[model samples]
Target: MNKTFKIYAVIFIVVMVILALLEVNKKEVTDWRKNFDTNEKSPFGLFIFDHEAKDLFKNKLKKIDQTPYNYYNTHKKESHNILVVETEVDTESWNKILDQVSNGSDAMLIVSQIPKEVSDSIGYYDSEISFADENVLKLTDKKYKNDFIKLDKFPSGRGFSYIKPQVEILGKTVEKNNSDQANFIKIKFGKGNIYVHCEPLFMTNYYLLKSGNIKYAQDVFSYLDDKETIWFVESNAKVSRFFMRFILSNPALKYAWWVLLGGLVLFVFFNAKRKQRIVPVIEPLKNTSVDFVKSIGNLYLQEGDFHDMMAKKAQYFLNKVRLDFLIDTQNLDDEFAKKLQLKTGKTIEMINEAINLIKKAQDPYAHVMKEDLARMNKLLDEILK
Candidate 1:
């Protein structure tokens, strides 16, 4: 599969596993109840509302209307319970709601995409922060100060306001504030609590079907187990804006750009500095004799000058016979012709006739008989033979 498909496949498998665990745990709880419909009509299938969670915690809670920030909002004033789950939430909305709940005795929990501003806000509200494994949670001991301070920090260091809760961090590599985790954090505001989870896959409808953290989900919304709870689910454009930030934060993209730059630099360096090798050049030989003869023949033929071509051929044959037999043209007798014939293995009459034909010139364009040209050609061939 292509890389993108593989990534999507991996995400799909992880979601399926979480949903499977949720489903399996769901079947085990015969007393499980559902109150709100999360899948009322969502295209992304990111948020899943638990009506059972609201029913189990009935009377003590109220599901709030989903603002332009939170994905799922459920509240329990009696139990001081407020649970917020979403892919992301706005800082202003979060702060306003936290301020409202902190004034009272309610607890708030938020799950969303993390921003530096949100992290700083969580730190502002909580006294103790601890990070362990890959999870971070902020705790405050305003109401139960004694119980909150005793929590141990991982690796025996001064813990931040947030503490790692349940998951073990040993042997697990934590990517430095990577966007892959979906930027999740939890904090306590006065008597209330707040949580921010980066990736919503852990709480999506597909994940709730088979999530292994049924107890965690229960604990998260546990205040609703005893009283009436409100389940509010929604999608906001503001929360989705954080997704763009998350995508741009990918380290792979940064590294890919760096690699391309490096490759371009190397290509320029090698091509610019390297010299091309020089080699000896050879001149090709030319054949002029055949070319010259063919040129003359073509020119004569184009002008319909057959007499000139036939006379040239006859003259060439006469020069060749004189050189081969030492023939004298001064004798002008059949004896010289006979000697030329005997030496060259040709008849005397053929030689004499070829000579006569070469010496005589006639009009080439005249309506000459075809038989005359044929006879001349036959005599020339015999003389050459």
Candidate 2:
């Protein structure tokens, strides 16, 4: 096989091997499909505490045991109170539900990490909550003057304060906006209320089992009391928002996507044919004697080396002429000289001069005078003519 084909074959084999290995590794993962969970799991496959928090919520609120939404819809005889915990709140589905609770007869309680984008879209008021004697403004237009509760000191040092249970906040509270101590917030919007925990780690399976934060988690959800709550365990809306922002912000990424699409188009355009390969016929090589002689003659002319080259040519022509014309070189003073004189109708002096010039011209180094070399070439040409 040719070198290119061998290299391509090796590369193809290696790529296939790598892909196979990756597929096997992917299959080895316990919960690969759960990678997209917003709160329950992170991108790196680590299960965040939010999943455990959801389970704890399910166990604590017996009414929402089967499904949070189902329980919310079915619990109509009593006060239609609902609770929602989410990583982000932006989807129209979530908004529609919130609107229903706010405008309808139900009272809703929502616990979530409200992304800034969603907060901005809904036009919520901004407020900051502070720790270590620092003041934090609330996001809502309406303000609440209250003492800050130290989260580190709660439930045997694992619990934090719930603040005033029902308050209005216009702007959203984010985990990044507040200090590490700023873990949770409670907001009242329209007729529904929201309780957001910035860091959901305390509610995770691992932390709940070990850190004794289960009591705090229970307290956070139990505020709904006997009210049915909808626990929407969905992916973070912010991730999608962030991705949209990135695509909109980076012109190069947009161009790169276009370039990739163009390449795919070209690939499809070129490889549409399904033709078979045809064997090529090889031809035999021929000798190049005539070509070599002509090339040498051209080289000699271009270099103006006529005196030296023509001496060789003249010698060859003289040998052939003598043989063909049946002239005897021996005794050239009589027989050969007379025959040469008759054949060319040239003077004996000129023929003799030609012979002497050919001998002298054979050696280029012997010709010191430029005029002698020129005369020699002229005489040789005349003899050949």
Candidate 3:
């Protein structure tokens, strides 16, 4: 490497060393974000519940990553209760899920809130809102009125005011002194029922690990009559995430990775430059007018066609006289020769000789010699000059 490249390398090493030191010395804190990933080990993840749910459904719990619409669409002949705990479902998928419920599949939506399109389709407006703390979850049935789960700090809160006749009240959220709000309900869709519970945080690993907290979730799910239930998670395999984390934790490996990436970028940048080809030198075309006249003159001399050559000379001389001196040589008699001598300021002898050559060339029966052609050219040149 050169001086500039070595300086950049030193700067990069220093930055990487600083980043590694900061990563090693940083304080560890608990991650309370609600992920609910099947493979995640976070407090809010469903890793614990996913393994334990097999016993509740009698070894018939099938975990899948597809949406409710996709699962039910593929397995049209068969039916099973579906559990959806994911956040932010699209309107089309929500409608398709309800269609599957109508066909014959009890779907439990344990989410933070119910979608407005679903509520509007069912002829009511119902959704959940996040509450600060001290929320109580209980069923609406008279006998289970006293049986309730109380949380000192929870986020699930909200219920609908207007209830349609087709809706069956299942559960309620009772705050400290506030009136009861229907947080959970069941709607009879053609051959099946759709259960909507707003308290999804209770089904996480944090709550399930607590003493007797899993029973509350079990009691809420006891309403489903299907022997087997299909749990929908995201479309991802339960694989190890330690390969990248292991590389990033070591300073040497991380530095090598960054250096390799930079080398590849530099290689591409240098190779992608525009290249130009060499332009060749071209000579101009030769003047062919003089060569063409010389070739025709040689051919005429070899053929011994002295009359044709003399005729060409006569035509050229007459045209020159007409253009330069404005003299007419149509008849080429004594009158024309006089006019030519006057216009060209030549002697009468040269003018008379040019006129005799022109008249002899014009006659078809006249025989011409090479000497006659040469004399005619000499006389015309002297006169025209």
Candidate 4:
């Protein structure tokens, strides 16, 4: 029976190991970022730029894969149309973009969420999510006013607006009564212009595939047609973060990393034996109670103060009697003797002898001897027993 149980346990462990290896090697379905990148081929990717959009724009569209700061710093004072398709930008990137736009270059910023720096500078802010029952957009331009293009139900409202005195309202929608919510605005920065369009989803692969939705992307490009180069910037982060994400996204590598972590834990548990130096056993310093009492007794004996020694011994004995029997020792008379004898279950003669010796020791003129201390010690031992 014991052999059978051992065989079954080993079989279970072997099966588990096989299953883990199989799981680690299993293939996973393709997972795409679904971002508004011009290079991706996912359902939500903008692969059209790699194929049709670049061709339509005369192959002048350039993809800027680095951070905005790096790209702008490297291409300082260069004239180009910049297209940023992210919802938010850091303060540094935002300032650099503003500087570029102010330097006589056209820029089209398509976003759903607006950063605080840009919102304050452009006088535009984000509104609530827009859920239009109809899949159409009402264009503000008179040329496209009659043209209503199909749009997906955007997760958030493309509501970016500025004061009419400061910026131009180029596009709007009539989703609510008595008000036309602005979805696009054009701001004149310095010698150039910065166009802020809230509906970037219209450029996505899913929306572009919809019937008559490509026209929306076409109109967006129409604003940047004068420039020979159009820089398409993607969302950026630190290099280390990108590398970690790349590693974690691979199933095989992720599993191997987990296995390595498990091996490390086992190594630390089973084989992490380091030779340590021997620690010397330190005996605690000896208690000085006995030495202190001996020193005091020797001093009293050398001074010939036997009476004081006897008084101290008597006081210590009385204190023990007071504590053990809960009796007062202010007057160590017959009452104390009777109490001590009753509490200790000792003979009255023995209790009386101890008490009489204590009383005789109280006189300063009394000559206490070794025989008296011996008798007193014997009397205390008898009473304790």
Candidate 5:
């Protein structure tokens, strides 16, 4: 069993070492789509190096690390316009944002898709843009109306299909004069306006790096130039803040953690048995009294010592008579015989007979026969009764 356990241990160690080596050498590619974080590698991520929008806000861009609703309620009196980029809005946050925007502060939402509740609340719909060839985007702004820029690639996803009649169009696709497929719209609320843009990836790494593309994004932000502070929501990228999140995020580390937990449980279950104290083996005691008595009896029988046996029997009988009748057994005279007769309810002849046999057995020089011993035993038995 020990040898087998050692072999399994060696195999397990070898497998772990190989896995570690493979993981060390593995090159992992960062998935860049729909990850609109502040990191550089994400296609939609805002970085100071690439996207000019970061420079446009600069120190004025205050990122809300927590949920929008929390920030809004905490700083409700403060007038800060929200800048939501490539983020899915929850109902509660959406409602809060709507309330904040309707009261005084404005908001700009740049994403590939918007939630159904938000879209329904403000008469807006989305369209699926086909990825057959390069998508040509046209800015309907009077200043850049003639500048229709054609792109090799754009963010592949849904776009704003329709908007309310009261919504003012800012940008549209150059394919057709369909206002229904407009990419940008501005909806006026109670005291502020909501700027909605369909393609957030246009302002990301791929398109933002293109020639003249930065100016186009700049022009789009021109609508919100009046706002002093822009609250950039950073909820999606919040997981990067936790140390354990990194381990749980990786497939190898997560699996290893589960395996380690399982091994610990198994060790506790098996090693607990090994830690218990050993139970001692107990031997039963021997009843040697009967055996010793039987052996001594057999030794006398083999030697043919009828004299010794008769003497022992006569002495034991006398001892028993002395103890039971409370009489002196030293003398077996006629008076003793009468006392023995009255005590035992036996005849005088019987007592006399037993006394004569006992006297003969008591004689040291006398050679007693087996028949004499047997007659003495019978006479003693009757006298005792």
Candidate 6:
């Protein structure tokens, strides 16, 4: 068993070394999911946008980590230039945001798909999103109308229709069919104004990294008033443990984790034991009470302790007489002898002789000879019979 264990240990060590070397040379793959979190530096994340927005809005820029309803409810009397760059919205929160905007606050919402509630309320509709490798976009104002931007290599733009009355068309895109569509619009409600844009991806980290594509994002923000702005951005990236972060930072460590797990599973399989055989039943020892008493009697006889043996014999005889005759033997006077005679129907002479022998045996200092012991046993037999 010891030799087998040593062999398995050596084999396991070799396997682990080989696995570690292979994992160390493995290459990592790129992640291509759209997270849009301010903390994430992925291709579709908003890390670049969140960092650069401070320059545009200055010290007035703050982040909202809660729902619009929660923020508005807590700070009911306060208002700011609100910027919402989100794909999904809670209906109640969106309505509350619109209510806050109408009361006094200005808001700019950049979303690819406008919610049905907002579209219906404003009598605005957008055309189906179109995909292209390159597209042309420009503002409506005459001074910037000639400043056209070609957002290249992406499904990055869309068009609009049913723009309704009393709305200002801020920006537009020329579709592949050579038809123009409204991409950005503004409407005044109560004491404030709202700007809604159709192509929200143009504001992400991808467009900001490009040389001239940043002009479009800047031109869009130029419409907002220079009020203190609160941005509602994603805040879902959680703090993680250092050990776990270290393991996940490298592809090699991730593969080593799998290898170690497989090694543990193999070790458990090889060391598993089957149920042991049923234990055998054992018989208890036999009784030896008579043999033990005989052995003790022989030891006393060998030591010549005749007086002590006679004293014990006298006690047993008295106990037997009391139990058999139902008589008290505390006093061994004439009454006990008379009672023994009556129970045994023996002669008075015989009973008296046995009682005298028992008294002599009970005396501690009496020298009990073999002849005296024989005579006492003979008399006791005759009286008890």
In order of appearance, the predictions have TM-scores of 0.31, 0.36, 0.59, 0.55, 0.59, 0.56
lDDT of 4 at 299: 83
Q: Which tens-of-lDDT digit does each residue in 1-385 have in candidate 1? A: 3454455556757986987777656543221122113543232243344445544465455555566244323332343444555424466666655664566434334333344555565553222222332342212223322211111112111122334453211111123452212123345556555554333333434334553434334444433234333333453333332223564567887677668767855555555555568977888788799999899767876887556656566566666767765776555466666666656677667778755565552344544333555567788677666
Per-residue lDDT of candidate 2, residues 325-375 (tens digit): 676654435455556766787888987776666556665665534466567
Query: Looking at model 1, which ten-residue stretch has the lowest summed lDDT?
Result: 148-157
- Model 2 lDDT, residue 170, Cα: 28
Per-residue C-alpha lDDT of model 3 across residues 19-117, encoded as one tens digit per residue: 888777877666688877777677888888887888877788888777656665767645678778865567777887777777887888887667786
Write out the backbone clash pairs for model 3.
Answer: none
Span of ten consecutive residues with least summed lDDT in model 3? 267-276
TM accuracy, model 3: 0.59
Model 5, position 283: C-alpha lDDT score: 92
lDDT of 5 by residue, 1-385 (tens): 3554565567767987987777678776665555666665555456632334457765466666677777767775555567888765678988888887778777888877766766776775666664324566667878986555555654353456656688888887554322335777888876877888877766666666667776777777778855565555554344553335777999999999999968965775566445458989889798999999999988987999899888988998999899989989889898789788868988889889889888888999889988888898888887776
For candidate 6, the lDDT comes to: 0.76
In angstroms, how far off is 367's CA in candidate 6? 99
Candidate 2 vs. true structure, TM-score: 0.36
In order, the Cα lDDT scores of the candidates are: 0.46, 0.47, 0.76, 0.69, 0.72, 0.76
Query: Candidate 4, which ten residues in sequence have the lowest lDDT sum?
Result: 235-244
After superposing candidate 5, which stretches have Cα over 4 Å from the reference?
Answer: 28-32, 48-54, 124-126, 146-151, 175-180, 235-385
List the candidate numbers ranked by lDDT, top first. 3, 6, 5, 4, 2, 1
Task: Give candidate 6 misplaced runs (Cα > 4 Å).
Answer: 1-32, 146-148, 236-271, 274-385
Q: Candidate 6 on 164-216: residue-level lDDT in tens?
A: 77888999887576567788999887678888887766766776787777777
Of 1 and 3, which scores higher on lDDT? 3
Q: Judged by lDDT against the true structure, how good is candidate 2?
A: 0.47
